[model samples]
Target: MSTNYPKPAVRRLKVYAFDPQASVTLATAMANDYVIELPWEQRWEAPLEKGPVNDYVEVIDIDPAAGLFYAPVDLDDAWLRDGGLEPSEGRPQFHQQMVFAVVMRTIRAFERALGRVVLWARDERLSSAELPPGAIERNFTRRLRIYPHALREANAYYSPDKRALLFGYFKPPESAADVQASWVFTCLSQDVIAHETTHAILHGMRQRSIDPSHVDARAFHEGFADIVALLQHFSMAPVVRQLLAASHGSLREPGLLTGLGEQFGRAIGRSKSLRYALEALGDRARTHQGSAESIAAAIAKLRETTEPHARGGFLVAAVFDAFVTIYERRSEDLLRLARPGLVPGNGLSPDLVERLTQEAAKAADQVLRMCVRALDYLPPIGMTFGEYLRAIITADTDLVRDDPLHYRVAFVEAFKRWGITVPGCISMAPDSLLWDSPRPEEYPALIARANGTPEGETPPQARMDPDDALAWWFADMLKRLQFDVAFDQADDGLGERSAESEEQASSCKVTYTRRDYRSGPAGGRNLRDLAMRVVTHNQRAIHQWLEQCTTDRHDWERLLGVKLTPACARVADVNAPAALRSISGGTDPDAVPNVEVHSARISRRTGPDGSEMHMLIAQIVQRRRAYFDPEEQKAADSGDKGAIGALRWKSPDFWFRGGATLHIDLRDGRLLRVLRKRIDDDARLARERAFRSGDMIAATAAVTGNPREPFAFIHRGS
Candidate 1:
């Protein structure tokens, strides 16, 4: 404890100093951001080495990046002696750990969202290939390089090209002397670090999503990042409890939870925060109006602004409102648990206070889970706030069918207040807006057939399990599409299938392929020839299957309602135009080109109940691939390419990028869900327009414009 260097261990760090915008801060003129010690129960500790190294990330200085920051000089000692880390002795390492801690925390958040480990694109080629499965990390990440002080400026960005987070620092304005002197580091702010980490994680899951295609595309990135960072502040249980107690149990009372980035805001001469959720505009008329009315008016005002951050504000506000509602509803139970005659307005006993804080923490945790899980239900392209609401409802309904607490209702109400609605929903009801389940009868039939249960015998118990339904349904559907349905004999839960039993199961398989196409003229293929190949083969089979699924003329027809279909496909036609636009701005009906079946494997996973949930994970991709040699790309970047080749290079990747991952529940043989990554033509066009207009909002090299030209003043010195 008395050595020249302080040892590293679990220690508390300031979660956030006084939120500058908090009413208390304004009244008290608090000097530093509040710090909280570590060892948080909810915090995830990644596999780390001395530079506080983790498998997925490497913390390094901005220079050559050869060295790493081992640990801060006893953050505990610094905090105990001073209010926070001293700017001169501890600020550098302080900023390093802050970035590392928040980045790890954000990774954990995304893993929760994806329901699996985040596999970065680099992981596929570099580290994973050599490591054993689940061995701490098999190809965790070569190094999602983090530069705590990459530039001398106000902005920080995640560069997909470099696969690194570059935090910039700059001299604080003269007015921000309260926080620091000489410089303000973006890396030092928890919000900025969390926000940038989200971008990296999102890119790993859905890389194409980084494209500035639609208004919501880039805005979704920014807003979703803010949501993660903001919600994470709640996980600092001590801070949240303190603020809640201070605000008299009212989260809406303009406290620490309502604002983000006080230090950054003050450094930039802003009075409150860099951005705020609970703050209302002048037109909001906060004191007199009801909660919903005020939220609605604020949303209306927000809509008048077209900037990505402003639009993202609408999403943040709605979600924040939902959180508040849930917290209030949950507090009701806590109040009931309080001593007799004790109410919220009156000070409660310590026991009751502890109970209230615990309940509030639980509410925040559940809300964060809901937000992350909803991502799996969202479409791969052209997202809108309305679609997000629907995704939330559908995702929640699938997981928790009965919502006694009306959490979904709270979300719907919040969105409705903002006048956001799913385009095709019949009403505002959560039930109506939710993604409809497959017809109940289809599962039984599919499961019965897959299990090869004799006619009238009660389908196997495993088949009766609703969660496993999609697996069998997918098997049956594939058979109908003329696929070879091979029951996984290895899966004992599906029953042993020997060579003899395999032949018997084959009887259930239907092999159908329509092949009627004329030869190409002079060895050249046009759109017409491509259409012939598609309509005559896979498209015809798909069309016939859709017809059967839609109608009830046959015994199966009445039972199966196909809820999924191919979103896009590719055709190879040298004589055809560069690209053929679909009539409805999607995929052409008769053309199923460049379709490749990647893999289809049946596996069993144990459910929370310990029941085996058979799952068929099938992946198929439409390759609208782009092939440009590295040297050619460099030449293009150098502006040395010919007009024709350059024009060709300018075209977008024609083939649909990431394909769909079908999650088929084999328990009851139903299509549990489909996770797809396909292009939306409208969104693609919008992206092109944005590129032309140079209005890209995301922090990525893909934007291809001057980082300063749009607003040079911010980056003037750097």
Candidate 2:
């Protein structure tokens, strides 16, 4: 019944020194006392020749004398040891920092998991830009934030295929080299730095899990990062002290540590709370910006619309809930840690910080592992919440081999609360394509098969229950199905969320087609999804053709789905002022005005390798292709209108076997840069990779109904 916890592995940590003597550090007398949290065998294997270019983060040793510390080298003993070597009496050491606070360790573990090397701050190229018109000119570059400057002016990039982390925030690591230049990102918010860099890691290691195509995945990506940043405050002794003092143990109270970014925006002049937005939403949820209704309602109408990250969003939800649990528990415990002696005059004590921090970090690591473990339940491409649970149960069974009771009990317990019931998917193998099995300590299944279809391949006969279809497409059910109190089977609990329903899906059906010989492999979702998109496209086209603007908010809601109700007829103020606040009561007033219109209310997920570009066009009718200024990018970026060079997927010759090697051609405004490439491999590997790519985004795929034949789908960008 209890966990037979494995003996802790003794880790031999080799801390690479960043000082003038970039070698001599660490106490020789000390045993390998550090815990090897992840087994070395669990580390991802990468060919030595293709060494981690972006796997490990590059760190700049903060020269304490100058007072600017962008980064401390990741493996430095000074950063890892308690009390470090700093002579300061009360100042905390690096080991004392929160688990996420140990930016170096975060980089190190991520690199091992992803098999890439990170280019730390010391490896960046910097250049100053002369003022463009309307640019807020400033000489105090040190005060500027990191990402805006780093992304625009810097050279670093996060590459998924390469699994590398690159940073444009570098300065010289050599002592002899003088620190002459001033970089734009000298003053960075810890939360922003953590959140943005995490996107890179998630992209490389768990690409499908965070696909923006799915609402859960998109919200998860945003919300989980927020939780990570929020929990990170527990790691910093001073930050925790200030926060607790501000809240007086009321962690849930607004305008303190929990003030969702709006009021904090007033404090620092930023638009949103980089933290606590979810907690502020209260028991009753609203839009992300406190605008209209909850995003769930908006997402309901978008049932037919599949976001790239939709399937993976469930994992994000699981992570957020765990953080919610942990924080609530920790907040209750903080009462015990409070004292009259700590705050000097009040009751806050810094001494309690050490234990509280260690506990928080340990809890975070466990949460991280649990979330990582949950990825096994996730399909590499698009999946539904029901299917996601199936994946989780199957994955956990393999990882713990049923020896750990918590794996089963914990997951089943956690999911049921969120309306996520466990499915009958437990497996010993990690997947059919790979021989590898799941690991409790290590992550498997980060990558999705090119094809969205599962290798199980065997399809289940449709019992023809609405619950069956609703299992996968609940969002659509919420949109289309109508239930009245008078006639609806309320006792059946046969609503959208329930797996049992009185109504059956008529207009839509999902079919997973791979070959002529193989049919109905669990009645795969390809057909169901395709039907939805077809309807959506037609609906959109018809609405646009109508040429009549809506008088109210819900005017077009019915047009989005089958159900039309009083809610659908409600009018919205077309000329109403911009509601920058989310329904959840967060605000982002200072957001760059040029950013594209993402509905602040709802989060949308996408397919695997979730695309940053949302544009999807049947074919741009516009002729005499025009080269316009940067302002037109939103059209292309949103995946709606014609962006240049979107035909790569359509071009079978260029995109077929092994597809074009992609590079960024910023030389012009194009998002995709490419060197045409083709690869030849053994038959099996080829089929698998082909399926993976084609199903995810348009590329070469096995012609449905033909195993031997492969066809090219239009690549969005070439």
TM-score of each: 0.64, 0.35
| Best-performing candidate as measured by lDDT | 1
**1-718 per-residue lDDT for model 1 (tens digits):** 6668643454444433332223224533342344544342211222234444554677766543324434433333444333334323235766665676678777866665445455443232222123221122222334588888777677777776667788877777777766644566677777878878887877665534555545666667777777877887777655666666656666775545677777677778776577887675212335544476765665576556556676777788778778878888988877665647676467666666666677777777777778876665555544668878888887666666678899999998877765565767788899888765455454455545445564347645545554344354445355543223223233223455478655654553321111111133332112222222221233223333333322222333223211223442233231211111111112333322233332333443332344454454444334332223435433433344363274554563332333454555555555765544453233544344444354434343235554322222222221
Q: Give the TM-score of candidate 1.
A: 0.64
Query: What lDDT does candidate 2 reach at residue 72?
Result: 28
- TM-score, candidate number 2: 0.35
Task: Give me the runs in candidate 2 sitting further than 4 Å from their true place.
Answer: 1-55, 59-103, 108-187, 206-231, 245-250, 254-272, 275-277, 281-318, 326-362, 383-718
Candidates' C-alpha lDDT: 0.54, 0.30
lDDT of 2: 0.30
For model 2 the local lDDT of residue 428 reads 23
The true-versus-predicted C-alpha distance at residue 117 of model 1, in Å, is: 1.8
